[model samples]
Target chain A: GAGVSQTPSNKVTEKGKYVELRCDPISGHTALYWYRQSLGQGPEFLIYFQGTGAADDSGLPNDRFFAVRPEGSVSTLKIQRTERGDSAVYLCASSLELAGGGNTQYFGPGTRLTVL
Target chain B: AQSVSQHNHHVILSEAASLELGCNYSYGGTVNLFWYVQYPGQHLQLLLKYFSGDPLVKGIKGFEAEFIKSKFSFNLRKPSVQWSDTAEYFCAVSGYSGAGSYQLTFGKGTKLSVIP
Candidate 1:
């Protein structure tokens, strides 16, 4: 079985541009999450989806960040008006959505976004 | 709000030396604790987790952690570390919030530099 994967391993964009990061979770995982990691810092939670709906999105920094998983398989994280402060590695993770199940997330190779 | 603390931001150790990385979390109600690791250029991988029962948990690569509820601590330990073990370690906590959602809150991360 393939692990979780993200596309466009590296992306460079100018400030105020828009970028989208894609994540393909493992087959049958019903839970997906996004996170951001800055240099010398740990990953910060961004948002989470359970099935086709976002169950938790409070971690999203602002309205400029949005994500969708319409078919309940793949997820895309979209960032609008990217700022230099937005430069960081974006990470995606997934896990089974079992009731009372302790979520053990499996991560994908992050997309390093550089806002110049 | 939930939070995690990694007491050591960076630690240096020699090969075969005993290793311990401290972690503490603050959250109310039921919780899940996790230790994740990232090798150079690699995605984050689960080292172990503690949800319920058995305070002592063992994970891959000769790693283990003891969960002490009273102290709100889950510390990672390895008796003999290899140079390959040099990497970053993260401690995270997850608990249910309102709206039937849960999000992982992570610490600042600990960078372990193992010298061979």
Candidate 2:
């Protein structure tokens, strides 16, 4: 079975520009999450979606970061006014619903974003 | 809020050497723990996870982790590591949250280098 995948494996944009990174979760997965990993740091949570609605986005550093998951399968992370600090690997993951019990999350290859 | 700590930033060892990586997490509520590995130019992949039951959990590639609730630790270990085991390892923890059930808190990560 196909695993989680990300598009535009590498993206470069100028400062103050806007960028959108896309993610496709595994089939039948109902929970999606977005994380950002900076140099020398672990991946930080950005947002989480359960089904079509965003359950939490508290990890977003500022107003410039936003993400959406439509139809519960595809998710897009949008960054506005991109800054050099925003350059990092964006990771996406998915897992089965959490209501019943714990489930392992499957991670995508991640999209590397560079802000010049 | 929750956080994870990896004691070592980098570790180097020869092939067939024993390997151990320490991880500690801080969360007041029930928690789930995970260890993820990322190879060179590859995405993060799950190595193991502990939700409940026995504290000792075994995973793929001859990896295993012991979850100690009192000490709040989940340590990864391998009796004999190969060169192919060289990679970055991450410790993550998920706890109950009103925003969502599984938003993860990750550690800075430990990079392991296995000499051939």
lDDT of 2 by residue, B2-70 (tens): 989999999999999999999999999889899999999888999999999999999999999999999
TM-score (C-alpha, index-matched) for candidate 2: 0.97
Instruction: Kindly list the per-residue Cα lDDT of model 1 for residues B1-116, writing each as its tens digit.
Output: 89899999999999999999999999988889999999998999999999999999999999999999999999999999999999999999988867455667889999999998
TM-score of each: 0.97, 0.97
CAPRI accuracy category, model 2 = medium
lDDT of 2 at A68: 87
Model 1 misses residue A70 by how many Å? 1.4
Candidate no. 1 TM-score: 0.97
Worst 10 residues of 2 chain A by lDDT: A97-106
lDDT tens per residue, model 1, A22-78: 999999998899999999888998988989999889888999999999999999999
**DockQ score for model 1:** 0.73
Per-residue lDDT of model 2, residues A1-116, tens digit only: 99999999999999999999999999999999899999999999888899999888888999999998878789999999999999999999999986733878899999999999
Q: How accurate locally is residue B25 in candidate 1, as Cα lDDT from 0 to 100?
A: 94
